[model samples]
Target chain A: MTSLGRGASVALTDLEKSYDRVAAVAGVSLDIRSGEFLTLLGPSGSGKTTTLMMIAGFETPTAGDIAIDGTSVVGMPPYRRNIGMVFQNYALFPHLTVEENIGFPLKQRGMPKPERAKLVGEALELVHLPGYGGRYPRQLSGGQQQRVALARAIVFKPRLLLMDEPLGALDKQLRENLQLEMRRLHADLGITFIYVTHDQEEALTMSDRIAVMNDGLVAQVGSPEDLYDRPSSRFVAAFIGESNFLPATVRGMEDDVVVAECEGAIVRAICPGRPASGDRVLLTTRPERLRFTDGAWSSSAPQNRMNVTVTEAVFAGERCRYMLQAADGTAMVLKEPSSAAIRRRAVGERTEIAWSVADTILV
Target chain B: MNLVQAIAGRVLPTTVVGLILLFLIFPIVVVMVVSFSSATYLTFPPPAFDLRWYKAYFGNEDWLRPTWLSIWVAAAVVILSTLLGTLAALGIARLPPALRVVASGLILSPLIVPVIVVAIGIYYAFSRYGLVGTPVALVLAHTCLAVPFVVTSVSASLSGIDPRLQQASLSLGATPIGTFFQVTLPLIRPGVLVGALFAFITSFDELVVSLFLSGSGAVTLPRRMWDDLRFAIDPTIAAVSTLTIVLTVALMGCAHLLRKRAT
Candidate 1:
């Protein structure tokens, strides 16, 4: 088969997959642009793995189209997809030498002997394991074996590389190192990298854009900063990064801002994606956005302030995290510079935590 | 008191194990002893040691022909059944759990059924098709008898293999078929060999099916021994039975080796 040309974007339109009518992936529609690195970030069983498998042509989608470069690949077998995929288990052929395993795909594609050898060589070089071709998979360490998997995937230069938690099996330090390596490889090769992971930190550090998934649906799609600073929903606010969500009722509305009251306190927030006026709202603010105050809401304070008692304190490297309990007893987590902390509060100390209206995003 | 109790605990189990071992091995020992009896009749602790019976086995033309036929037919059964059964096992292992259980039951049903009923049906069916008394008939019936063993052993072996081994092969860019041939077949070969040995031994030792199905032209060793028993009790017969026992033991040893290699 002739190889599919580059600039062929992988677009899934209303893709749905169900197993025994359980609806594993419920109406997942996505556009993964050519040469873009997109990570599908979600907790386990949220259907991110299913969606990735569907794109790799392993699990057939129950409904909708998956097109590569505008060509529908609904019933195409994985071998014919011209797509590279890495499994969580790092499924290298144990019987074959590492060199033979790397050459396997090219052999299947009927690349001539000389050409296949040249390509395999280039791949080994790219992965920095140039002389590892003769070694068996068992002979190598976990990280080296993972590098072999990556090299094999990129050897044929498939238009898209689908990774199903490829680093999920590695140790923490190894996983982070692979994350940075993958980010660099995705940039250097200019191939569309569709990464799947449950680790929020991994998605934040490596991807060009992240699609936060929950229960088989794309919850939110945005750059890291966008997802961090202005999440569009309560799920997104909680799933993407840690955030303090307070159940609040909208007190009033400005041009685009809403004043929501919770636990005998009022705070101004930008309406996240514009929920209706007078609606029950979820007010979210990051821990770093919160600042410790001297037990009073100053008139010149940015916009929103609440008086609460610090119930617990944690010492993070550069900051001290304080858990403040409002009168209604909803614990709010906030971080402040360690030096500026109020002598590091004990369990029952009182302090007012404040943030600007610009800091809180109401959904 | 403590020393006496410890001695009794160790000696009691050893004696019990010795009794079980003796009970299991006594038949083979008696058979070998009776084969060498100079009186030319079945006896335990043979009255006299002699090579006359062994010589009688070689001199008898009827005995030599059927013995060779049995050996050749068993080899054929081993070759054909192992190939078919291994492929079936691989396909069955890949199927969903419910389908796999159903397929396995159907394949192994012959083993569960009574041999007399199977022999009778095979006899009537072969005779009607003009296949009775031919070596082909015996070989085919024995192959069917051997196939389930092949299926079971191969399936057991394939089950122990990691399924992700195939998926790993595919993600390496090899097609599903390529993965099966290269990665899967090699890993499951020990199981296949174990099945092959069983298939060979089953065909070699089979009596009822051969008796009912063999024509004038086809005479396996067991069938020959059965016919000889009706006519007369000969020293050559005892010699041949002893030889068959030795060969069966050797084949079982090979099976043991194959099973250990599989793990």
Candidate 2:
């Protein structure tokens, strides 16, 4: 119940790691705030795990510096860094009991036997594994072993914790439960947590800020809502969640929004930078944002509308997903909440889909 | 045809296995029976049974000296070989894949090379250093033969453990050396123990190398038995063989128990 160590802010300056001249983490620079739960979300081979290893001192950076609380840890050994790390495979010591494993770091620091035991007990309780300390790691199930690994990592009260896909080996159901528990633990401990995972949904559910990585570089870093609602690049948009990308040409600027012409229709979208008129661009929007114009819903704000033919429709339990083809032969998807009040459109039906201009973004 | 094939599949292997076991065990049974013979000459199916040969083996100073020498040399080999072999296995495990193959094959070459060839080379090498007749010579030579077994046993268990456990220990604030002692060493202890037992047995039962390096001053039990067998038809050699077989089996059982406890 007591708070863990105070969080330490980390600053990675131009961190780079390469193997045989091929860069795994190519020019990554980010400032992580204290007490933040930041998830590195990316596909495999995106260098997310490699970056985490650099911070943990397992992999030496080819260039750049890693500073924790304003102190450089470039050449410092992992032991001297005083950081906590949880491996994906739950690397628990098979020779030691749970209590001994949790007490390992404390014992290394020369904490007295009695004090170490007390801290180990508190750690087990923190991870909801009380009274299981006497058992060996092999005696416990996979989830329990991971909990013990977590307890061991935090029992030393490390200022910064790095987890490399800690919940990766667990089943989906257990992974979901542990994700919430990890979030609660992050809140309670108030220590910095840098997690690496390829699962976007897990990152979205847990991270305060998610760094979406692609091709060995960070494409975008922002809050989960910021990433989902306004992705900065095509890679981020496609990696984070499903998006309907439409090719368009810039016509002119309307105040701050860019007016783009798509499929012979005028579409207005928000762009962070100004584009010259007649420049080609791509626009992206969420499926759920698109609605059939035949509905009674109407907004006073200006909207973007497109006519499309339903190529495929699936009546999902909670939502109806319809695949549509635009007039220019571009594919798009529309999702609507299933309700008896709204009639479901059959395949091959032509309909006009409307969305607010605010929901659309030019990437 | 199906019934005939099934009977052959089961009965053929059972009969072959039974014959092979009997062939392997017959010499040991013969020696055990001969150890209890009252006949002064080495003879099987003795007219009467007694313990004179066992008494002669236990009471003779020449036999006792060699037995003690063998035991002490084996103990020393176990200590030296286990330490060296465990370190070698650890080094091999850390090597890159291409280099690891070369290093592992080099370490295990003694196992594949003929013992007589190794003995001749060691004899000439140790004789040049004037160590051919000393206990140190036997200990050193036996350690070379014993080390390969230790390396093999320890390597099997070393490869079985998760390398991440050491990384985890280091990340948790344990120094690299501390991690080895606290985590790595304990996990591979069963393998080390098994290796030590193998080293002991290898040195204890060694004859070809002892025949080459073990002069009169450092004659091991196997060398003394060989000398007795070539010079005289003594029943005392039978008693010694029986005792050696018992010691080897008991040590092997100890190794098996340690392995079981570890798992």
Candidate 3:
């Protein structure tokens, strides 16, 4: 296989796509670095796929511009874009053999037959489907077909690759294995990859940076850790993983932390932006971060504590989950690792939960 | 009472279906048997088996001329209709839903209209253009009848294909024209082949439109066969009928096999 070299940087400036007065992708502007695996992650109808399609040149934007490596590609046809794309359904030509399908693009480029065959063989090996070139697409299993599709897309060594939910139809076990393989391929090729998927875990696992989209716009774009640890919005916090929100009244700001009062108890949370005193805000934290104050080894660090009654308790295999109601009737959840040495809290039990100020984020 | 109902449910449908099958096939069987008769005229229960009528059909130039005309006309119709019909189907597939329904209905109107009505219209229209009694007239009229079948067959095949295949081809750097030849055409080939076969059979067996157009210059096999039956009753007519039946059935069988392979 030819070395792909460094990938191209892509920039979308106020890109928009609408049909009959209804917008499918509304004003999305994002900058993707060269050789980075950027994932457009969202739920269905969030315009992630539409945004990817526009970048691939399959869809013409209603307004704004798309630039690849500082060159405008907005009006270019898909065939002239020189970009590689893989669809969710593994859109292999049903009549063509695996080798023919992979060599199709090279043939269109007027590559000699012998040279095309060589690249096709190397691509098949890269996708781990060596020596299966003579078979038709219908003869292969679903996983095998997807591998062929990936091989076909990358066989020509396109600098930039676009994938739209490529692993969506596979079973969970196969999807996980392919996900690791894709990540390995990305590292090996040093090519920029723009992946679109609604699976949050897939995005978090594979992306160098993720753009979480909602309602046809980017809600937040950051590294997975940044989005999970310090989400800038309530939607980002709730969408990334499980979160507990506590309504609080901001007293004042102290440096980067906001001092707030919640459930008649004083609390401090790290805020991304400054909020005025008396501002009502929601303080969010992960369920696993809250600990029972009665336990020994409680740290001497400043902790935000809340007094609550356990409304529900269930002993999961890996952890004990407690649903609690604060004195002001605000519902919250706390999870503790399952261990025989730790006492389990029962329903109706009153307890004080403590978490460090660093774990709480004011959104 | 339950046993009677059960027997009636099973026996009634079986008897009715068997009777319908016999009703449909009995005439063809009689014609086929008479074609092999040693008699001088058309008659069932042959006194002896012989190939005299077949030999007569092969020897006579009057009969051979019309047969060749029919074959050539059908071939021309197949070529013209398949090209037009395949293009029509492709255009229809890309149409918006509401307009698509209207366009398809218009294309298929030839099938829904009465044959005699279409024949009369074609005859009057072609006479004004001095196309009557010409091979071009027969081909044009037959193409009108055959195009609907081609459109229907090709449309069925087009629907079975995944539209994303074309997009994938385009994104892989193949031009639109290249994508159609490499991906779209190969995938929808079975439908096109079936449509061509239908077009050929439609022209070969057509009698009503041929009657209007095949005056004296272009006398098709069906037109000559009608003349033979009306003027002279002979076992030769039975022989031609058997041959026509075999050709039509073989063509239909080919179409059926193509459709099966496509699925």
Top candidate when judged by TM-score against the true structure: 3
**DockQ of every candidate:** 0.47, 0.91, 0.88
Q: TM-score per model for chain B alone?
A: 0.93, 0.96, 0.97
Model 3 CAPRI quality: high
lDDT (0 to 1) per candidate:
0.85, 0.93, 0.93
Candidate 2, residues A255-333, lDDT tens digits: the string is 8899999998999998999999999999999999999997456889889998899999999999999999999999999
Per-model TM-score on C-alpha atoms:
0.91, 0.96, 0.97
Q: Which of 1 and 2 is ahead in DockQ?
A: 2
Tens-digit per-residue lDDT, B42-72, candidate 2 = 8879769999998999999999999999999
Candidate 1 vs candidate 2: which has greater TM-score?
A: 2
Better of 1 and 2 by lDDT: 2
Supply the TM-score for candidate 2.
0.96
Clashing pairs in 3: none
Question: B56-86, model 3: which lDDT tens digit per residue?
Answer: 9999999999999999999999999999999
Ten contiguous residues with the weakest lDDT in model 3 chain A: A1-10
Q: Which stretches of candidate 1 lie over 4 Å from their true place?
A: A1-8, A275-277, A295-303, A316-319, A337-342, B1-10, B33-43, B46-60, B94-99, B161-163, B168-176, B230-235
Model 3: residues with Cα > 4 Å off, grouped in runs: A1-5, A295-297
